[model samples]
Target: MKNTLIVLSLLGSALFADAAKPNIILMMADDLGYGDTGFNGNTIIQTPHLDQMAKDGIKLTHFYAGNSVCSPTRGTFLTGRHHHRYGIWTANVGHLPKQEITLASMLKEQGYTTGHFGKWHLGTLDKVISSKGAKRKPAENFAPPWQRDYDRSFVTESAVNTWNPGAGNRAKNNPFYENGKALDPDDPTLAGGAARVVVDRAVPFMEQAVKDGKPFLSVVWFHAPHEDIEAGPDYLKMYEEHGEGAHYYGCITELDEQVGRIRAKVEELGISDNTLIFFCSDNGPEGKTPAKRRQGVTSGLRGRKRDLYDGGVRVPALACWPGKLAAGTESDVPLSTLDYFPTLGNLTGYEMPDARPIDGQNIWPILAGEMDQREKAIPFIRGNEVSLVDGEFKLLLPKGELYDLSKDWSEENNVAAAHPERVERMSREIAELLESFKTSHAGADYNDPEFKPVGKWKNVGSKKK
Candidate 1:
């Protein structure tokens, strides 16, 4: 406890000393698993850079993505509200609602430049169907990054190849658009590994922000190891002995290298002391088995991808803000990507322009070691699966199973019968939250007293099935 108090005191001072609109870079991996990196104890995958990154800063042991999938999780990260409140139920199911305020829009109000790189599955990049007979039809859910408050963006509507992103049929259908202009497929800038291609765009954006002497928010979401997973010859050769695992493992290693690249760039630009660099996957790995090309292991956790279990949402997370965060520290404080907005907002002293139910609480206190247990329960909903990790107990509805995550990380034992009172209380709390989410989705959150010109909430999910 002595060491904890000392770390907390130092972190508090550091946070204040560098809290004046410091640069922020949020990096996310596309379907990376908890057991995929060396820091998380995977011996086969070579992630030296990521391992060193954990040593250099705080490693989050129990971090969670906002959802078990990409699109909804992205929405939560940007808006600090449940995606259900905005009608994003699942992947490729909805677009970002214009009525919702994003982190980009928030930071932009504070005079920060914002840029988004890599897969933007929140909406379509091309609104009109290509006359050339591309696979993507006229996008009914058309919401591009440029339209969503990003100053400069190089993004795709959805997934592309892990390598040679621009040269494929997928590229023809859903191409990378820079500030609303689709790039030529043969553009030389679209070459090399997917992670590298993303970082290549991100680095210049940060440099220019520095050159302009403005604090920046650079969101780099890599598509490596997601689907159509491939790696360059060098990366494949590194994991050749793993058989089919080579493609999956190699793509991740390539992704790790780019993570190191971003860290190195921040240091090179002399912004290491003020810039916050965070890393995590959008969700847990894809596929049920670690066979064939989809070899994302969840470190012995229960479900994969779509399930509302630890393996589906719990992810490997690392945060490095040199001179502010303590080195070689670990926190099991059940954090979610939902906390990004509130945390950054508090750090920068930016308040929401209007009153709304922001599901994410400010977690700087948790990160600074002032607190351990989360005050607000992290809730999740996918289709009919509803669960909320409240303190140590996670209550899964419909299934009616309760697991004390503090004791059973694998969710092997159910203690609902033993703790009937606890289960009853938590269930009531979840029901209240779901009802609140329903009200928010129906356009109650917008049309503030100031009469801001916000769009009406469109029910994207109604058109889904």
Candidate 2:
């Protein structure tokens, strides 16, 4: 009887361990460059919290966003598929389709409370009151976070002033919308730092989930240092050498402080061990005249925001899950935001719908240090631009430039003529992937036969098919 009781106790412990699911918090910086933080060897900025997070987490050395731009990469984060597959080809081009499944919808099935805090450029926030010079969605094109399966949402339609988000644009604007209504313009709770207000809304939602004894997914996408950058006087004093660019550098430090707050909240709630936190940028720095004044750095990497070179798509990525992922560990394996859906799906036992194809693979094994490389190569497309990276060799087509990333990290050498065979192989791969993407974009992925385009163009590519 003594032996039988001991065996039963051990079995119970194992079962309970398997039942616990990690809370997921995904944070992304707005137009943050590759070498902007200390983790990536930046000497100019003092991002103590982000630097500490890197020291305590698993650093992904070659991680990439879905696209070189904002909206497309966000689409990839939710669906774990290419953005072109669902019609969000460019920033503010369309909304996330009702037919497509999202990570929030998947987590909801498994009883996880989900919240989205920060930028929501997936579609229009309201039928009226659009920000000037900002892309506005038509009444029919309206798709907000509530419509996208997020349980609780605090978001803005697009970029806003980092210091004064409520004022000083072409039109009188209050972009911070809660649930489904806009927040009061004079809401003093969000008067100071925009990043602080974003985290303020997020932490409460997380605390409520813990009180309810439930798992959660919190998305914190800060609008810091995006455009019209301005930092508080205290933060501005931190970087006086940059002059007018002080706002740009100081705002990043402010955002880092909120990161520390969120980290502390998890510890205060005693959920740090059972929670997974991932941080990255939406894309590279904005390339227009905004970048000229923003003073962002790309770590000596060539190309900026809208281009597919390593500088544009590659952003700083870090993952932390105490007692799960080892501290201070780093890997150079290439990864994309597209892998999030399949990875989380495997963790929570969520089976993907069979009617469509999923571009992302199960990367949980890679995260746990079981594998060094991905099972499939990541493919990218934005307008006429396309790129295919298989381990060290990278193919950037239209120009057909080939670079061995292992040897030439900056992509300065044009080795296409040296290795014609490799170029031919990658070229064939891009063509096949493009055809598949075209089929998916034309409504073949869903059961709806009468689906239609939601925005400006049917297909906006630099080169015609």
> Model 1 Cα displacement at 452 (Å)?
15
Where is model 1 more than 4 Å wrong at Cα? 1-19, 130-139, 448-465
Give candidates' CA RMSD values in order. 4.4, 5.7
List TM-scores for all candidates, in order.
0.92, 0.92
TM-score of 1: 0.92
- Judged by lDDT against the true structure, how good is candidate 1? 0.85
Candidate 2 accuracy as lDDT: 0.82
For residues 346-426, write the lDDT of model 2, one tens digit per residue.
767676667587887666556667667776678877667789888888888787899998898899998999999998998
How much is the lDDT of residue 130 in candidate 2? 55
Go through the candidates in order and give each one's C-alpha lDDT: 0.85, 0.82
